[model samples]
Target: MNAERFEALAEAFGGDVARWPADEREAAAVLMAARADWARSVLGLAGEVDTALYAYAPPQASVGLADRIAAAGPRPGRGRWMGFLWPAGLGAGLAAACAAGIFVGAHLSAAAVSAEPLEPVTMAVSDQDFDFDLDGEV
Candidate 1:
């Protein structure tokens, strides 16, 4: 490994060769063997940061923290009906729209009938359709 790569690995893995990636450990070892002094300097800097992080202690939460967080959560009744009614409301709205369309169609048909005069319907008969002779007998 190059000096730059060795320094980068030391910084990322907290100067611990064991913490370095398994594939990179061999290359890092080779680099350290070639440049012991330079590698130690980089590792020393990274080790200081690691030591500070390991020494840190976070503040503990109070006993009522969970209860307070739970109290801040959504109430049971909020949006409860929406889960059950969303699809049902969509179906009801579609049904209303269909009913409205049918009502408008019927109203339009009735208006058209009253506003225009009706015409007589006639049909033409072909000779092939009726070939029976009329001999004045039933």
Candidate 2:
């Protein structure tokens, strides 16, 4: 009903009144009629801008250029996961190799430790003080 309410309705519906609901259509029509002066000013400004835009002509485009570009198709490349696959595979291989090395080292260490023999120590006395002298008259 008021200018502010009309402006809000206009902003929501834009210039197309057909998009508004049947119940609100009558109210919008009444508001539009009441705000004729404001509507005329806005329409005049839009018309001037439209005329200015129409005055400038775009440059002529080459024939068949758009078709040629469309026909060229997309560039050749890998997918998003393709870039990560190689690095992931490489990391897994390195981890497996490290695990195998650790296993082998542990086994070798265990074998070396088990194969070593422990030596036994003994205590004995030497008999070097007793000497026989039976070479006098024989």
**The best candidate in terms of TM-score:** 1
In candidate 1, position 123 carries an lDDT of 73
lDDT of candidate 1 over 1-138, digit per residue (tens) = 888788888888987888989999998888889889988889889999999998898888989998999986666665856556555785886688899999999999999899987778767775455555687442
* RMSD to truth, every model: 15.3, 24.7
**lDDT by residue (tens digit), candidate 2, 32-67:** 697778865644554565566678999776998888
Residue 112 lDDT, candidate 2, scale 0-100:
74
In angstroms, give how far residue 18 of model 2 lies from its true place.
Answer: 9.0
Instruction: Evaluate all candidate structures by whole-model CA lDDT and list the values in order.
Output: 0.83, 0.66
Residue 20, model 1: lDDT of 88
Worst 10 residues of 1 by lDDT: 129-138
Off by over 4 Å in 2: 1-30, 74-138
